[model samples]
Target: MDTSTGATVAHRSWRSRRLDPERSLGLRLTLTVVAAFLVLVPFTLLALLVLGAWPPLLRLDASIAGSFHGYARDHPAWVGLMTVWTHVCGPGPLRVAAVVVVVWLVRRGAPRLAVWVVVTMVAGGLLGALLKLLVGRDRPDLLDPVARAAGYSFPSGHALNATLAAGVLLLVFLPFVRYSGRARVALWTAALLVTVVTGLSRIALGVHWTSDVVGGWVLGVAVVASTSAAFTTWRSGSGRPSAHPLREGVEPELADQRPEGGRA
Candidate 1:
């Protein structure tokens, strides 16, 4: 009986320690590092394969690109729709949207959050550009092409920007959606939909290989995870409440403001 009582007490103690925000910060940061590594390693391997022109990857890229082009030729309407989706959700427009969000955040008195948004998007964009240049991969060469994009194609710019934009906006508005509810579900669904569809639009238009889209996704995710970890560290050091960005969003205080927060 005594042993049973002691075991119960120890379990409760351990659970409490795990729940302690101050104690868990290190673990959270470690997990972020591991996640970033997992994301980057795959991207690096893909870039290497592109550079070396690995046969298996090249065969796969050609097969997929050819199939997509075949379908694109038959379906003019679908091709047109994909073209519009690609352009509307492309990097340029998404960056503009991110800029608008930044302005909104600053006006709402969350300059830090605004800065985080800018840094995340800009850094992701610049990194994507750098990787594209370094990889120096060419776009899928399709005869009777349904769409066209001019750039190195190891990582689709549209995919990277859409992913970064989705991640930034999702984190920004997550708090406002109350963490859990239909609103939260809708926000996540929209972000995911935009990210995925933008990537697919690139493939469907016969402009990017499957590997290019995948690389973009991996790199974009790495950037977001890295920046989010840095922001969380800053919050902890500044004596803010513990942030579980995956759960409560990056800046919960954004949604917890009073009327005065909106005033000059």
Candidate 2:
């Protein structure tokens, strides 16, 4: 949204041209479909597992957990690291981080994106909680659990919290990262790495079946995708397509057309 070069129509061309309602609607529908699939597929899988509809997937979960359990036995340092990761990626820490992120977004004048972040986190939490209650799957039973976690284990809370936070943050910041393509990709990669590591940590700890972590990922993708679509819709309507990062030297004229706080 830089405006230093006088008139700067070209600078704003990308946003203006790309914000077409038809294109936006198409993107929104695509995202919604993807989200719906992510959500429903995982829920159906959980139902099947709960009802013993597919005994093989349960055996596969056990086999994968067994592999992780075997690997963890020889890697004390890895076990320690995963334990630390579990606590750090737990719901409590993720919620605190989400609050910090939302405040940062609000301060950067992208309150709409802030709302997206909050809503995604909340949705992920609620969905994970509900799935756990409905499935009532048990945790992995190992002779020596490297780490113990309580409650139902159909969806790994650690994995869901990490995915929701990382996924939403990535989506929320993507549109504003126009200047640094490498940085954008690197950020996305880092988010993916953290999410995967968190899921793996649960398995290594012997606290969750492998399917639980997978379910967490599937459910988290749904919530994050939904939030992404909502955020883009808000950005298209609010005219602050580049409100995030706050690095654009000059704001666009459309930004002036936005509300006083740079929000919708």
Candidate 3:
């Protein structure tokens, strides 16, 4: 009887500690890191490994890549269209977009978010570049290539860049979405569609293996999700006092973000 009573008490105590907002906030961040960086990143790499180093999978990858290239060859018009989004969501464009967004955020009294945006975009791009070099996979070859790209190719840069650009923009603007109706839903849907199309365009253009695009998506989502987790932790940990529209408010994030914050 005493043992049973002790077990129940311990369980409740543990639950209380785990559910504490302060600790729970950190816990959520940890989980996000595990899921994105540890799990998904590794899985993506392993798939690339199989696709790159394994003979059987290599044959399959080549077949699909060739088929995609052939389709692009037959449809020149589509190639032009795909190129439009690919260029818009490419590394250069994404960097420019990041700078523009950050400048706007800073001007709008959201300096913290501006900093976060820069860090996420720059850091994510650097990480993706490192992974591509480490993997050192080659791009698809064609006798009559529809388009040309230069770089190591285990993970598609276009796909990764597109996703990060779309994702970061979506999240940074989410706080200001101002409504829960079709406007918000449509915004998200459009972002998602653009990301997907950009990734597929790389495949169709004969520049990347299907696995490469999949890996890019995984890596991109991981980077964005990790950034989001950090933001959430900051908000829940040091969030400031505010009267929310619903009378329930998440904290305002870093002390530096507060209007009268001691630290900038």
Candidate 4:
């Protein structure tokens, strides 16, 4: 009888400690941000579509597409280079690489980072595909040295993949990598530049409208932000151990500290 009473008391005590509110603010905040982002992004995109904003957007797309079309028509060598580069940076291969990297991170015990990467990729890819289907915008039809692509082109996949990849990489490395501030800045700069160039490549290849690329970038950024917030919450709730050795053996004083590193 005494043993049973003692066990019940201990269980209640553990529950109280686990549910302590002060340590969970970060988690609450992160979840709130994620919820807000999920609501806002789709609404904004729908508003833009419903307001008939595509005409002006498409005109801008054509102007940018025209320059690439002209350049590709005149410079066969440059066109060939761009064609190859575009294929190299296309959604299929980049997404595969992203998956491999994410799996590697998970195996390395950075499961939170891995989850964020995979979530961002899947969310961005699905969202982009849905938007493309709904918009159903035609690609620029013009003289091009490179082979033409066919599909309902809105929200360029290249741009989506580039932005998501850059965003995921930055999130994964920034908090974890032991790098100088200048190096971190340089790394981010390079990532941003790569993302921009990837988006531009779609326009250059005459495979996507300018609006498509811009929309993709916007969606990608939103996905990154929202997914990061959700990941932060999940990591917090799971009671994972600290990666920092100095913090080893210290009982988690906050919600962000999870036992077993939040592994399922």
Q: How well does candidate 1 match the true structure in TM-score terms? A: 0.88
Top-scoring candidate (TM-score): 1
List, residue by residue over 21-45, the lDDT tens digit for candidate 4.
6556453564457566775677477
lDDT of 3 by residue, 225-257 (tens): 777667656765665332121111111332224
Clashes of each: 0, 0, 3, 4
Where model 2 places Cα greater than 4 Å from the true spot, the runs are: 1-31, 237-264
Q: Pick by lDDT: which candidate is best?
A: 1
Per-residue lDDT over 33-56 for candidate 1, one digit per residue giving the tens place of the 0 to 100 score: 787888889889888888899999
Worst 10 residues of 3 by lDDT: 242-251
Ten-residue region with minimum lDDT total, candidate 1: 255-264
- lDDT for model 3: 0.73
Q: What is the lDDT of residue 169 in candidate 3?
A: 75
- What candidate 3 gets wrong by more than 4 Å, as runs, is 1-16, 19-23, 37-52, 241-264
> Candidate 4 — what's its lDDT?
0.68
Q: Name the lDDT of candidate 2.
A: 0.73
Alpha-carbon lDDT, every model: 0.86, 0.73, 0.73, 0.68
Clashes of 3: 3
